[model samples]
Target chain A: MGGFFKSSIGRKVAMALSAFFLMFFLIIHLTVNMTSVFSADLFNELSHFMGTNPLVQFALQPVLLFGVVFHFVLGFILEWKNKKARKVTYFKNNGAANSTWMSRNMMYSGLVILAFLVIHFADFWVHEINVKYINVEPADPTRYYHELVEKFVPIWRVVAYSVAFILLGLHLGHGFTSAFQSMGSTAGRKRALQNLGKAYAVIIPLGFIIIALYHHFNHH
Target chain B: MKLKLKIWRQKNASAKGQMVDYDVSDISEHMSFLEMMDVLNEQLISKGEDPIAFDHDCREGICGMCSMYINGEAHGPDRGITTCQLHMRMFKDGDTITIEPFRAAAFPVIKDLVVDRSAFDRIQQAGGYISVNTSGNTQDANTIPISKHAADEAMDAATCIGCGACVATCKNSSAMLFVGAKVSQYALLPQGQIEAVDRVKNMVAQMDLEGFGNCTNTGACEIECPKGISLDTIARMNRELMKAHI
Candidate 1:
């Protein structure tokens, strides 16, 4: 592990593996959220199952949280290491002009996404656990979950979610292609992998956008 | 053809720089980009204003001295060609062309359009050379036959002219592609294998010490590179570094 962290390939592999974990979570997340557009009853049922399923809730949730934390930690460490390698200062010049806008701005975008996550968890996760599991809402058991979706229905909320989702899409687009290349997946099928990346760049954001618009248009 | 030029001007490294506009008329379409600039400088001198100070030598584009960020793209808008090779016909009459020095924290402005790319020289000095003494008693040309594939790849990597376009085009200001090319050139050959580990480590250390950013592999450096050196070189370097570390 120390040897891996010391080498450039090792750092890249760490980043790629962590990113893979996050991508897996993204697929599961998008699928679960998409169910909300079909029926609130079905979505609620799924949410209830997710909440009650001991195996998934106990085992998977901790791993997912660990993945997010580890990914972020590795990203910052690599960025800092790169910065430390540079020695001089220039007056007015664009540095590393060949990288994507998303990759370059990942640190900033990741922070923004983190802020959104905080608000997101507070508005939904906290309430779900507090009201449903804790038995705090004596009068209204499903009120918190319904209110969470209601917040998403508003135009401003919809716009906020859309913007966040777009950032995620941009991050994933570059991250996907980068992960493949980092893992020594060069030549032949690499082109196919990059194409799949480009497709995901468009599709995943579109998925989030559709879900946002669906609730915005169909809900109150 | 006539063109309006907005060229950056600075007295010295510490001085503030600004874009001073000049109009040149009847420029021959046959003139190279540097030649057009020469005409503009002559006009500036005749008008009693200081000539726009820019770097150029061996206007054949081999010197890697003609560093200019023309119209937001390094070495103007042409692909796989240096600014010296870019012709006047690429522009039209009355076109407003903006020319500035390549921007980077490491590449300080020495004068208008001329930057102190000695940092690159320093990086090269760090470990870019193979220390072989040839006192006219060296081995024959066919003594060691390098494979055609390895020789081609080495030649491709050696094609890098140390122009700094890769750094200019990179968003993070990374010099990985440039350094990678140099490292790959030597790493692929038997002559370079003796010091492969030390060569990569020293060169990469120098590159970082020069304040270049990390590589994100956006392919922009390749696109804007006058030599069209591929990002694959950087990937190869990364692989080499990984092997050395392990």
Candidate 2:
């Protein structure tokens, strides 16, 4: 196990595992958030359960946080080590002649996503924590829907969220199948996996975008 | 045809390098790129100047010895051919061509346009071979029947000539494509089953130790490889490593 972790493929597999976890978390998060579009009562109920549940707050949340941190740290470490591999830079490199732009710029997209994560935690997670633990406020299940709608009211926040989601789309565009490729899953199923990845990359972020726009426009 | 060339010139391993320009006229469209270099070298030799150094063997593109980063692409703008195989016709008359050696920390420059690729030899020595008995009891050639699909795939992987073009073209200077081809050439065959686990583990360990970067699935290596090795070989190597760990 130690040897596995130390190997190059092992580190990549570890990255892929964390990516799988985070992508799964995104699906669940979007599903929960999308509930606010139709019925406020259902949205508040689900949000309250998710927010107040002991299993989610104490156990799953910590794992999700660790996964996020682990992915970013290892990603940076890989990028740093990879950079050191080339002591001299190319005089004229035609990277686009062979590879896709998204494949080469994962770190940049990742940085954008990281910035959005910080703001997201401040806007939602921090406030949730303050209300539940720091302020010792009484539980109000009905407040969840109103709180979500209010956050999307400001045009700046809406624009920021929309831009971040689009970048997230670009991140996932290459990352979806890339994670699978790292896991050695590119056998006869490559075409299927690529198609699935394309759909997933488009749909997940689009879902978040629609929710944000829907709330921003329909908050009346 | 007349051409302007910017070629990297370095004295030795410890010395700094810079691009030196030269003019060569009357280059034939039929002449190979290396032949054009030969004309340039002959001119320098006649002028009592130091000739540029580069590697070439079998100029037909099989030996994998010739390496040149021409006009931003490995082995020039052409696909499925080494620098030796590239023809002068690909370039326009009087065009300025940039040539540099394959640059990677693991592949340090020994002189102008020459890098030490012995790191690949070390990685191969780690576990690139299978143990065979020569005690007059050698197995028959027909002992194992390999499927046509596996045999063809193995042949494709075996086509790699250790040219280092993949590393040159990769954005991260990753040797995964080369290593992957090496691993897959064996992993796809029945004869390599005995040491499959150790082969992958030790080879990968040596590769990491060599300071070659990791693969980001950029697909540049595949497009630039003189042998046109597929990225599936990389996936196979990953799978082999996973199976070994399991």
Candidate 3:
């Protein structure tokens, strides 16, 4: 309903729904990227399929992009509104006395993630788009693996990605259970869900980190 | 214990406020924080100076009228207690204590260390009650049997004192915990089911209209709450709101 999107709870639910979509996208992306560790042919095959498939490029890609933009725009708006709620500042607020550093500083962590996203898009997506659509270059399935490995060969790029992944871990550390809590989940399963969230936060980012580090070292 | 105090002082709602320092000596550690304030006021009155104004009714902590951001906390450094219940022993001799009003756009400072909490009352008035027929025949109270678990949880939600500590301590000044407690206390009961959808929708609408921030699930409210009201109540309210939409 139109009214639902206007309310605070409704807006929170909308944020949570977008977060869920983005989190799911991470898993698929990581799985595909992980294939590069084993065989170049397999990685190339998967990359070519994902990069050129009509369903992916034309349909799901736009939805994913929309979800990312929607999440960030709404997040910034909510942060701005929250800041306006308190006109006067507290002389001394001990926020750590009651809440986690990450929970309170979501906007900052999200900004870091946003910065990384730009670099990520520039390094890979823009190039992919140019190769496929703009330049209309001939399809070379083997080009995918070499390009990905080459990106990780630079130390600065590897370090930047590693730092971004660590912050991503921190972002998901709170955001995972937070998203569920926003969905109105009951307390009975809270402990289990939080544990699951912790594991996910660590594993997802660690997987990406290992892939980055592995490529940086093994690109002989 | 002898201590230095820095208290916020303002002439009126529109006046500029500043922290004024005062020294109180020969104080006993056993005295309640408010009693120490009383001593300070006594000293001020004898000096022909105006006493710092603050809010407190039931020193026993049930009235929810007592509010002070003491030393960067809602109710001093102690956990699960209001300002009136905080004892002087929490601070040491020669310690300088800082006291200020609860800061929120919705809770404007009226004078020295006192804020207008009428925003909470308005939110409650919006939809915090259930409809009951009382003209002729009233329904028997014992007719409905509620599970013990539900009854206890409802009672827990009912324990919110409306002290605004949750709002004061929250980084975003969000009042979700307070509104959530009000909504959950009723949504759990069959007596409250008839108006359930409207209750959540209206209360949330009023809460937003009052300039309270959206909850980011920081869990600060639950930790700072005197009643230890859980974040589950907030989740329940979210669920209720979602169900209402559906």
Q: DockQ for each candidate?
A: 0.29, 0.79, 0.87
- What is the docking quality class of candidate 2? medium
> Residue by residue across A1-220, what tens digits does model 2's lDDT show?
7889898889988999999999999999999999999899999999999998999999999999999999999999999999999998888778889888889999998999999999999989999999988987888989999989998999999898888888888889988998999888867989999999999999999999999999999874
lDDT of 3 by residue, A1-220 (tens): 8999999889999999999999999999999989998888999999999898999989999999999999999999999999999988888788888889989888988999999999999989999989888998998989999999998998998999999998999999999999999999899999999999999999999999999999999984
Better of 2 and 3 by DockQ: 3
| Candidate 2 lDDT score at position A150 | 94
| TM-score between candidate 2 chain A and the true chain A | 0.98
Model 3 - which docking category?
high
N/CA/C clash count, model 3? 0
Model 1 C-alpha lDDT per residue in residues A1-220, reported as the tens digit of each score = 4754545556677788888888877787788878877767767777777776898788988888788888888788777765554333233344344456776777777777787788888987787678756866564424434764688677988888888878888888788888876765634567788889989878888897897787678766
* Candidate number achieving the greatest DockQ relative to the actual structure: 3
Q: What is the lDDT of residue B8 in candidate 2?
A: 95
Give each model a TM-score: 0.82, 0.98, 0.98
In the range B1-246, model 2's lDDT, one tens digit per residue, is 999999999999999999999999889999999999999999999999999999998999999888889988999999999999999999999899999999899999999999999999999999988888989999985878999999999999999999999999887888999889999999999889999999999999999999999888888999999999998999999999999988
lDDT, each prediction: 0.78, 0.92, 0.92
In Å, residue A121's CA in model 1 sits off its true spot by 1.9
Runs of candidate 2 with Cα error greater than 4 angstroms are: none
TM-score comparison, 2 vs 3, better candidate: 3
Candidate 3 — which residues are off by over 4 angstroms?
none
Against the correct fold, how does model 3 do in TM-score?
A: 0.98
Please give the fraction of native interface contacts (Cα pairs under 8 Å between A and B) kept by each candidate: 0.24, 0.77, 0.86
